[model samples]
Target chain A: MNLSRRDALAALAATGVVAGGSVALADDGTDGNVDPADGVPENVIGDDTVAILAAVGSVVYPDATTGIDPFVETYVSGRLSDDPDHRRGVVDAAAELDATARDWFDAPVTELDRSTCDRLLRELGVDAVDPDPEGSLSGRVRFYIVNELLYAFYSSPTGGRLVGIENPVGYPGGTESYRRASMGEETEHGRE
Target chain B: MAGSDRTPAPPADVCIVGAGPAGAIVAARLAEAGHDVVVLDAGPRYEPENRERQLDAHLRPGMEGPWGTGGERDAYTSSGERHYPLNAARVKGIGGSTLHWQAMVMRLHERDFEMDSRHGVGADWPVDYADLRPYYAAAERELGVAGADDNPFAPPREKPFPLPAFPPSHSDSIFAEACEALGLPTHSVPNARNSEPTDDASACVGYGTCKPVCPSGAKYTAERHVARAETAGARVVDRAPVQRLVHDETAVDAAVYATPDGEQHRQEARAVVLACGGVENVRLLLLSASDAYPDGLANSSGLVGRYFMDHCFAGVGGRIDRPTRQNHVGFNTTECHALYDGTDPLAGVKLEFLNYAGPSPAIDALHADEWGDDLLDSLRDSYGTHLAVGGLVEQFPDADNRITLDRSTTDDHGNPVPDVEWSVGPETRRAIERANEVQRAILEELDADIDWIVGPDETGPAYHHMGTTRMGTDPGSSVVAPDCRAHDLDNLWIAGSSVFPTGGGMNPTLTIAALSCRLADRLDRWL
Candidate 1:
């Protein structure tokens, strides 16, 4: 059975023990912030920006009853513990996302309502994504998305419990064929 | 002066040389069956923090990246000084060629195994499809391939895939839709990367570097199998290059290693499995000169280096008008899966549309950067705009297109290195031309700016070299029996694509994996 995302998370939470330090959260099919590692950037994200990001992230991916899980908060927050690269990039994206929100609606991104944030995000998402065709933002967005999701997905308590993915047994593919001629008899052009 | 400390090692129950995909497979399987196994590879262990740089001679000059520094130290020069060359694409690492492969997996058609019976050109394998289906299933389970079990185009297998097809990249889905519009069916391309974390390794982060060592554990490598065997009591000696299979009439006595201290340690084995892959395996056999077989042990047929073959490559790409959601990480998308049955005008031509590995900066600097605005706009819009469709035409085995010993050249270890004199055959060249035509047609159908081009006739290296030591039914005509056992040597075995008596019109990864699995099962009874 295709186990509902909730049942999977609840089962893991009940166990209170899982691999990869999974932080239970949502899965809205968006490929952003998917890593479950504990390398999400913090401090770089000011208190106001962090709230805005959480709100926006939650709205973009709400904690539905049948959702894959939840927006792994503590997990994503931990990824930025000391991550210099993502820390630097998230601060800049937050500034730009906040600046764009202010220009659109006379308020900081964290202060703005969900609907207003959504509107501004839709309008500014184009710029935020592929921000600089020739500049380093191409690399920055990758860092931002991964760091933002590190806590959200990879490091979550339910992180290792992904859909259809598993710990491969033996050789994922079989071992290479035998090489040397064994002592067994060689049949009609076929010995095996 | 020789060091007084050096002494020959003891005999091993089974000595599987080279920890490449082929060798690792045999070793892992044999070890699984509770046999004593000693695995050796030329490369030392590598990690992302201390990864080896890979450089190809074909890369443009002044190219700076992790790949640029690959050939810096281990460069092997060709006659042309244009390239400060090294066969760095082929590594001495634990995983072997799979370390650098794109992980395109496909099963060879029935004709591939029995080419002579149908095509009347190559030799037919003694082991048929029925003998290999179970192993193919096992291999799929091991690699965690994300594909439809009902792939209508390729050869048939016993069961469905362990996982459903992964979500395609935006452009890949669009191109696939476009191909469907043009009366061509598309399916998920087989890849060894995880759609989800199925192993202890990290999931596949969309860094778009599947052709190199995957930073995350999402992709499967030999280390997994090596680890499994080692846990089950196997000895894996990394950084150990087996210079020669020191053997005689009875059995392989031992292997002479060229270690760091310029010393030779003869490690013996009751039986030896040569898993060094196409070029090096043949080179190793030829290098092993003895009283019985001067040309090479198991060279009774003189077919060791006769039928060299590789799939011819041609690439094509252009911009897609709509932004696709497929640009996400993981096994994002596959393009052009159903194009090789030797029936379509492009039959011998296998198509591989662009997956996630997007454009390179130098290539963009050369082609995309026309005007400032257009350049920036294209690059920005092209965060997923550029869609590439690559074609791999079936390369017929040419007797002359071979790898021979260049008595003069030597690697850092000072062994007489292998010299490859290879070129495309007529049928393959024609197939490439036809596949290019199909690509151009698809580009036109997609209705993107028809003028832009990436690489139409330009060729990439055939890192997937095959068919050097082809296995066949006849001892005089082929090198090995169907089970990959060499014809002349009673205790010598061959693995890898070299025994691919016939190269099919698909990526050789899945077929090689299946064949290896089959060999392992046979060895269960035979050993």
Candidate 2:
């Protein structure tokens, strides 16, 4: 169940899909098919996977200002690369999602309409393909695809500001002034 | 002094290993008093700018390799029966482990010195709290401790803290209200951080990242003291790992160390101070085996690495009914000492209320299967509503729980790594249970919708290492004397929490600083 990145790529290769460069748009405005033999960067997702992630991200973090696709890609390329198990889970989940899309709509997941993609993802739920036996296949997909996107969004400077935190732990804003607002009055024993 | 062309160097008045809080204090005190002092550290001296860069790198995943060229930042190897994750908790740098410490400054209670006399458990400190009272005040002043003067649970102090206690956050207010309702004693825990700008450091604006690194120079670290010692004429050397003590039959003469480039250098000194933390101090002593004392230096009693102890810790957390902005304030501000008395079969316990933002690691397992809206809802409902209470329970020193040399594993320098063997005894287990019960009761009293309760089995590392080279009146039972001097070695002194006879239910940094000041005074009189 603990799939490596190599195993995930091999599985994709078995499907005859070529792993390619950065995601590109087709002339018709659909996801462009690229050669899987062309090497993808160390942490970057494949072109097809990137299109699938964008489709899934829009549905997951609908309110995100800059959209969740770019953030999800950056986080996956950087942080997710360090954990191979997690990366593998994400890759396998994306492949299964594409397979499910082809089965229902006879088109790739990224080619489907926004509402169709949302309904498809919601229905997939825990029924989605699980790559890791020790871990739930659906859970792994949720973590790598969904939870990671949420983590990147919430922990970001923009997202933190949305939550009223001027400076999150890692962001670069000066320290905050100590405020006593909303903290009840200090009593004689220093209890509020 | 030997008059040879190959002579390493003139002997220093005092040579201290490790530029930690204890060593920096000793070096500064001696150097300011016109004594030729030299301090050696195995890690690089990271300045403020460098610390910020390291902090940024540490926060960003896949960016942890930029601190140092080599892996000297985390050089130690922990093998054998380690119940807790020891290696990750400790850091090696110019400031030592204080670089990552939360800066909670609390003194060992008066009864901590007389554990045998009061509770018939553990050995009594040769020197009482009265003996260390002045030194404690001096340490607090030096560290710019901020605490309320009216904290009833604090040990009696002659002078008020340098600054008033920081204002409690909403989470602290909630905890305080709960403690008051439950009839538990609570107080604003003293912190080694600046509430206002000190003459040397900036004020703490509550950046809230005190653990891995402090962006602002608000937290008190030994690096500042090391810089002061350098200004006061102490020769500070970094990236120099002390190998062994070069000694004759009667007294120690010099210390041999290895540079980062694998070059060996010898430094002769009139007096030697081992301030390289609890585990390293014992390891260094054992490594410095001599013909006269084949076992180890200052280890004639065979108790050099015996009786190692760390505070037993347990954490309890649950969701509150109402949403809170708990993440807006400092991490550790409030504490409870209701169960600090030895009336219970278990020893005293200190509980701290932690303030942190979303995605608590405690409940990570629960979110593994969650996806989409379920995950989002879980995060929103649990993020700010999450409150945790941690207990630092007293641990009795056991000779079996010790640090020994692991010949199998070697560091980059080819030195045998330290193998720590430790397990909590029945008393610590009972204390942990009691501490968990106390935390649960507090949450229940506050009407918190309890989800899960965690005890010492799931508790993280405590990081308070003590009693590796304990001090006592008898040379047969202890490694150091009441004055922190090695029992067998005439001019060898040991500093830091290693010399503690017992670790009370509190942070040991303040006590370690106080003990270092006391040793400095004793050395001054003796010299």
Candidate 3:
């Protein structure tokens, strides 16, 4: 079934009925309980970025098609709470990328355009390319976004199959036992 | 494959990359046979006459982070994303992985070589046990390993051990007694550390930190062989990553490398031997994708980054019911238990009672998660009383499990880093479950009520990734032939565990070392 506004409304009604007013909200990727319309979460990924993600991630990650929660969660986690070093290199190309993300969105990146989003991301240094450490912050953020998107993509079954990694599968090898060694007993000098 | 007869860069008779044991062996043998040899390594040039660490970056497990030890957590691809050929951390120094490895040299049983035919699974190595037996002996001699030579499962050898086995540590004796009590035979283990000096390096003092960089240089590494090759006039370039294996579809012409300064330079050779390792070797092949062979250089079968394997490992630790002190005779006994019954009908898991290093504080904290204050008091009361049994499972070959390069993700060198996509299959899970049952049974033998049992965790990565560029007789099915020469490209050879089609639940260093020796003799023919 298509996830229409009617379906969203019905789900929202159910959530509201199930839990009083403090139902956990994912308006901008925050884990806390908050109302989506009232206000946004602290450091939310933003509406436009989320829309772009829903688009790019849908193509990039197979998990998006099946709606696997863990991979999605990891992707969001990588974006909002990732280390600076993990950011996308596009942020390094700085001005050029920021403008493209905005132009691609046809507005501010806060309301990005999904169709031309990845292309803009590539221009900003999202895909594999020479790393530009010159532009630090935005570049780092872009890198993080890219990282999360890729992680989710691989975590998906399709991504896993294409890459040849057997995720959620059984052992590829066998096991055995033999005697070896370990640390010595602790003594007055020190633990062996 | 660049589709041009653009003469190979910096021409020489032979060019070998990475001055590790594998690389050093190939270079030394070729150079001694009067070939103009050049070996490129990404480590400081170590002069045997006078050794000093000039910008050495050796990273071992215990010494976390990229500080004193030369290991780095910067291996993740720059796609700002996932990187595979995942978890392979090599020392850029002259010695390679040997710099931080425990010098426990052991070979796969005869059954390991023919695991495919015997078990109807995995792929059989192109060469048989008999083909590698002599090479194993040669590698052991060169490394100066100390063993009892009485191991029932150990491959046969002509050379008597250079020295006796290192005296068992306090924990070793306890293991022997327990194994014997349980009707299991135990013997002293073979090690590369000398009780006395083999030549330049010192002997083992049992410092208990073998995983980190060895300060005494007692451990056998490519550093020694590199020195020998250097003495024989073989020039080794350090801090250079061989970017491409400059080759056409039919022949390996030369090697293209990026210098430490990031300047690109090409070094040509009549023959190029690859000992870069299972992960990097295959990755470098995939990345050098050219027109003559669009899939990848020397990748006729498209198997460059496929069939990745790691020995499945998990702990079997139990708290002593009562107060008991555990000590050592030393490390791995000559003989172990009846678990690794490769020849028996009851064989399922490859069992070895290892004397593993102490658990990290993080692991201990996890183990002592419950019981709060009582846990602290209990820990203090029974510290060394905990006995851990480790088992190595054969990581069978699966084409779906591999070391593929993430074209979308680049590395520090502006090159695509490997994005490892690994997860166990049903067969692996079944094996783990079966082996875990055995581990639990053995732990029960120690005490009545099991105190703490730890098996496979959710998120774990394997350090020993093997079988990516697997060896086989058929050029159609494998990347390299039995002699480790690339099936698609003549004179392009590889040495190390990367050639292994199937691993029999054991360490790959000895087998790699033996293969290096074998490749040396093969390269000596120089047809």
Candidate 4:
């Protein structure tokens, strides 16, 4: 997690993916290169796992988040690249999800339509179960897949603004901004 | 005998143990006074550049490595009635706990000094508030305390604080309205954080991560004093934990400490000052047992590790309709000490209006059962609407609630670790319940939906360790005398909250600094 933006860029280059490289890798599933959205090297997590995670983010995230695919891909790659133990758990969960999708729809989760993917996740009991990394299959999926995507989205500056938390805990915008009573215009979207 | 093979270091005029606020101030003053001082600390000097990474560690789920304190070196045993998370709020680094402290630095009340005489419960401190008034002012200037003379309940001060007070947060303003309705007084809490730019550190930029890490240099850590001590020509030895005090019946000879190279060295000094905090102070004394004093050096009363005390925390939090702008400012700005000065037996409660309350939007969203728009809605409803009141209540010292050597378990150095057996009696429980009642009234005045409440049974320590090596006039019942010198040993002295006779309701760091200053002046005169 302490890996700087420059370090991340270097890591991406080391994995044969350069910054602003190409969308061809994302378009064609055959190539090992990931989508050059955030320049998070796909070598940490596989392209198929990234694709399924992106699809899952679409189902869980608000419909307004049209950029969820790139956002999730970038977030997951960054998240998985931090700790090896956590990466193994997340990777295993993604594989479990892909296997479940193939068993039900006779195809991978990324190939399924949006509505079918949503139904499939709910049917797998991810929506009903509590997120536990060491719990059942549904719990692991909810924890490593669903919860991970949600954490990535909400903790981001853009996603935090969607719910009126302009300056989240991790991001230090500045000092004097807290003197203001509210985020003002930004609070309107989250307000009832 | 441990470090007998190694050549003893050149003798210093004074040798201080622990580089915390207590030891730092003592060393700085002594070194500035042209005395040769050497300070031995158990931890490393953390770099300021790593604060961003420390903040990231705090932000991560489960808050791993926030203070970077753990593993074998920082190990201890807790056998309390209520399980004490010993490492929860401690930083063993060069600056000590001040590196991650919230920086609230209020003076102890006059009543806190005369607790036994007035309340007939805890023992009275040998030195009263009047004795420490000058030192209190000096400590405030030393730490750059920012405050307003608004608290009607506060003890009389000679002058205004060094810096102006930080403005009350938006949530504190909201809570102020409720407090006004309940006839409770509210005022800006005194903070060691800079309100404006000082010579040493910058003005607080409200990084909002004051507890685990302060990204900005505005917050005062004891590192400033340590730096000053070093600049004043005090030799500071970090990663050199003092193993034991080499002592005699009438006086102390030297301090034996262990270094990283797996070698022990004897640091000979004319005078020794133990400033290793409440728990370790006792542990070091007990570990220094010799043929001359089997009950521990300067512990003829057998009270070296007795009368351990800490402040118990109580809180009540609930959600309101609109945004309270929670966590906009990391530190609390408002507090009420009315209950602390009251005549009631359950009066030692100091209430704080927490600026940060409830969980972050990320946490709420992550834990939500709903995924899509419903999760977003839940986050909006729960994110910033939280308002909470926290209280710090005093725990009177009990002989049974003490720290002893856990010889059964060895530390990374293969030495016996400190075994903490802490427990709060009925008085503490009553005080916490009383605090919750006042907190509930303030929250209910705002028509908040009462959700969570931390009553007596659920309360935890504020980590203000006190009264282990208690200071009193009597040698029969106390370890140190009124001047913070050992009752048994002539040349040895104690610093920090470990010498406190009673644990007051306020934050102890300011008081700890004040006492350290007083001890320095005393030691200077003696030397």
Better of 1 and 3 by DockQ: 1
> Model 1 chain B, poorest ten-residue lDDT window?
B52-61
TM-score of chain A of each: 0.46, 0.58, 0.41, 0.70
* Candidate number that wins on lDDT, 3 or 4: 4
Model 3, range B213-251, lDDT digits (tens) per residue?
444456677778877877787777776777887677788
Q: Which ten residues in a row have the lowest lDDT in candidate 1 chain A?
A: A167-176
Error of 2 at A116 (Å): 12
Best by DockQ: 4
Q: Let me know the DockQ for model 2.
A: 0.09
What DockQ does each candidate score versus the true complex, computed on alpha carbons? 0.02, 0.09, 0.01, 0.26
How close is chain A of candidate 3 to the true chain A, as a TM-score? 0.41
How well is each residue in B1-527 modelled by candidate 2, as lDDT tens digits?
Answer: 11112224478989899988999999888888888988887777676765544653544332353334335333455543555466655666688888878889888888899999988888899999899999999999878898887667777887889998876666777888888888887778799988789898888755556776776778888988888888888888887788888887668888898776658889888899999999889989998888898988889899988888888778787787665454554457778876786667457789888776345321231233444444445545455577778878888989988888888777777788787878777787788888888889888888887766657565544888899999999999999999999999889999999999999888999999999999999898777
What C-alpha lDDT, on a 0 to 100 scale, does residue B105 get in candidate 3? 75
Tens digits of per-residue lDDT for model 1, B360-453: 3222322221322333344444443455677676766777767666668676666677766666655666666677677877877887655443
Docking class of 4: acceptable
Clashes of 1: 48
In candidate 3, what are the lDDT values of residues A63-149, reduced to their tens digit?
Answer: 224442333332443333322222222222333445566665565443445445545555544443322234343344333343334
Q: After best superposition, candidate 3 residue A16: deviation in angstroms?
A: 66
Which stretch of 10 consecutive residues in model 2 chain A shows the poorest summed lDDT?
A8-17
- Residue-wise C-alpha lDDT for candidate 1, range A28-113, written one tens digit per residue: 12223433333322222345445555555533432331232223333333334334444455656666667767787999876777
